[model samples]
Target: MSLGTVSQAGLLLALVAAATLSGCGQQTLDNSQDVAAALATGGGSSSPQATERELPTFDCNALGERASSIEMLICQEPELAKLDQQLAEVYAKAGDKAVNEQPPLLKAEQRGWIKGRNECWKSEDKLQCTRDSYQRRIVELQARYHLVASTGPVFFACDGNPANELVTTFFETEPATMIAERGDRSILMFSVPSGSGAKYQGGDYSFWEHQGEARVTWGYGAEEMLCKPTTQDDK
Candidate 1:
């Protein structure tokens, strides 16, 4: 992995710490208090209903004669249209789960996300950006709602640091969630794909895999980490 100047160990540590902090109050764990405090809040809406709610469906046909530029572009492109259909299908399943649970907060977030997605029309790569936004959001909902099955826990030992590792355990939560643990510390990570590889994000950190290497970042203040896979016991 060509990570340039980033410290792979620090990046892995930051990612694990951030994930642990996000899952703090949501579940009980035998971890440190410092980590607990860090997990108390997350990068989600300030709605109690954030954890449960109906996923929103986007309709290109429903727009009829009055479609936004983004919608029009999506409908005009075959690939984009396919993505839109896929997103709608997943939204339907997630919405069913949300209606039974009645999570008003999630509904609100969907609306906000739609607005942000539409704003991508102003970007240089409008079509690609819009398509990516849909794909990422679909991954988030599918993972959050447990609409799809998770393969199970995956471990990656950081390069140059035999003692550092990342472990992810998937769960069937109201909004599908995962616990990422490294040693006695753990954090929450939500599903968000980065290309064909799985990418999880929480708080100030994110973990992604590309071309068989794990790329991670702790926050805006830290450099990214690229590490190779090794035996879980290698840590």
Candidate 2:
């Protein structure tokens, strides 16, 4: 992959960290946390390790409407829409639970997939029998308890990737979620495809093949920001 600059490499490392952080039954992390520790430690582009890590930090709970939100997951194998939906349901349930149970107001961060429907452009697979079969739901977690927002495409992780492994296929699937202490609000980006198998510090990560699985990450606090439409013709 032709990464143009060191910053691009950093973004790839963040994505690597994102993609490498998922699993089954108390799935322990093997390759993601190194970047995690770096980001957590506040190390910026100055680290060489950041230059080589190309995978994304894997969390199945993030969701959004735009393609960039979910990054390469949907860009490559969008067939996992149904898988995304199941994961959305999980997050929806979790949000409901959190709202009803009303956990402590203390600051915290967490992200995971909840099975549900996308509030925006929801698409169905070509197979009529399997319409909505793919993971359809996507969400980007937030601090102060909100699963989705008026943002971009959401990402998720599930039990496995089914036979349908293209942007055209969609299958029913769920994902792993975890509530944890929040981190920096920096967004994760994709600098290289998961197939690139790019190596980082003797560790090459691969996540593009991951279908039916959702990935998400949560951070500690949130800053209330505002949004407004601007005129295209004006500077």
Candidate 3:
């Protein structure tokens, strides 16, 4: 990957994009092999030291009920403040866990979560075409980020260096029967809602660079994701 061998246009695009990559790490991971050791799954070997994990099962009905309360809580300014803090910690750890995760298997579980959400949305009348649009985005991300899919109740792990092993991260059980497996370099967010189990509208995985805080919500009567970032800081 020497600059000398690259075409002029390719070099130019890379340079232009580099400007926006201010937050990117000093070194980039171009291939999985280069990162394999750091990314390899322990082959189901449990490490007593490792404890943080995702939920093994989700009941859509129960999760949706929970969402109703969460939605209402998140509506108020104070609630959003607390949610941002809690979610910030959750993602800090989850992002790193994703790197060294069991690559093939984790992917399978991810796919199942997506499919379940899609079916739920399709059956529900409120979402209309929203579910289809979100699914397309998920496909784009899976390929772009080299993520895999799995059955429902999938487990996710990070494929990163062992020495640096994800140490400073937070883990929280996202109790949602309508789970949405998602995130990327730009944004990190996922949601599952009430009543209809995995069926609803607007709930979808979303990621975007240089964009405002966004949400993928589903169902009727404004049944959508609400990801409003801290704008004014209660000033």
Question: In terms of TM-score, which candidate is strongest?
Answer: 1
What lDDT score is found at residue 119 in candidate 2?
Answer: 18
* Cα lDDT computed for each candidate against the true fold: 0.69, 0.33, 0.35
Task: Write candidate 3's Cα lDDT for 31-147 as tens digits.
Answer: 444566644653432442232232112222355543533232223223233333443443344445566765644456546654543353335442433333334344333323334
lDDT of 2 at 146: 41
C-alpha TM-scores of all predictions: 0.47, 0.18, 0.19
User: In lDDT terms, how accurate is model 1?
Assistant: 0.69
Clashing residue pairs for model 1: 19-187, 19-188, 20-186, 20-187, 21-39, 144-175, 144-176
Q: Which lDDT tens digits does candidate 1 get at residues 161-206?
A: 7566767667553344676666776666676655687777887777
Off by over 4 Å in 1: 1-66, 100-103, 151-167, 170-203, 207-235
